[model samples]
Target: MILTRFKKGDLFVAVVTATLLLAAGAAALIARAGAGDPVAIVIVDGAAVDIINLRDARAEERVYASALGTCAVAFEPGRVRIAAADCPDQVCVHTGWISRPGQSAVCVPGRVAVVVRGDRAEVDAIVG
Candidate 1:
């Protein structure tokens, strides 16, 4: 075995660092739990048309018709999806489902976007 030595303050620094890391993790989990629920905001043609609470929503589909095309949006508890759309690409439909805050599905051809928003204000990005 090889002999090694540690400075007196080394163990204290390590313990303090570990404690801070654990505290940060616990704070994050508490914040997420305190965030009541998430909601989906529907925007069409550059305007917000609807806001649906995913937590309280039941299984259902809502159809929206705009000058560009028609799109069908489906909602279930804690999630939402683009069930169908007249857009040629079908990208939105293929997106399947989104359940998390800040998630979104867009149908470019139809000019429709569904964005999920959390009850708590989240810092998505910070620009310098």
Candidate 2:
């Protein structure tokens, strides 16, 4: 019987290729799972002004000059928009919907920012 052997360099290359493929698969899975989710809320001066939901929406409404401090963010279904803000720039008002994890919209003058956070649970310690 004859046996075929793999050289050290060949084995190393094979291992590296496997590792790269695994990493690519993991990245794809993460991207697919992270699509369209609400990640965070931005607050201004101790009040919540914006709520960012990472999903596309049909329509967005803006409400300004309200008693509740002049800035607010709202989300409906797969859509997010700045509902209100005291800032004159009104840039956040036009930010519109963000339909992916890690997406964000901000209003500088209002001191409000919204960002997405991952859903993975923290692993505090490992037990042997």
Candidate 3:
């Protein structure tokens, strides 16, 4: 069998590697869980039009008019999504709901972007 080709030391190394990967994944999940509530930021034409805290947001839809067309954003208690858009490509709507921090849905043709951000001050990007 293929498994017989590996030595005892190889099996030990594989087990250790798997254990470390699991531990790292668990740590990442724990950190995200404790990072505080997440908020969704709606940007139109490179300007923030709305910032809704997902924890306290109501179930509703907000529509905005953009340069290319209009778009609708739906907000739930702990998630947000782009429901509809008039752009040619419906990529944003296809993205579905996003409840985690750092998730985003963008309508390039409509010039609209919805980004989810956590309360924790994590460096989103470095521009140099």
Range of the 10 consecutive residues with the lowest summed lDDT in candidate 2: 117-126
Q: What is the TM-score of each candidate against the true structure?
A: 0.68, 0.44, 0.67
By lDDT, the best candidate is 3
Candidate 3 accuracy as lDDT: 0.90
Residue-level error in angstroms, candidate 1, position 93: 0.6
Which lDDT values do the candidates have, in the order given?
0.87, 0.59, 0.90
**lDDT tens per residue, model 3, 18-102:** 9999999999888777557888999998899999889899999999888777999999999999999999989999999998888
Model 3 worst lDDT run, 10 consecutive residues: 119-128
Number of clashing residue pairs in every model? Answer: 0, 4, 0
> What is the lDDT for 81 in model 1?
94
Per-residue error at 105 for model 2, in Å?
Answer: 1.1
Question: Model 1 segments beyond 4 Å from truth?
Answer: 1-35, 125-128
Cα RMSD, each candidate: 7.0, 10.5, 9.6
Candidate 2 error regions (>4 Å): 1-37, 45-69, 120-128
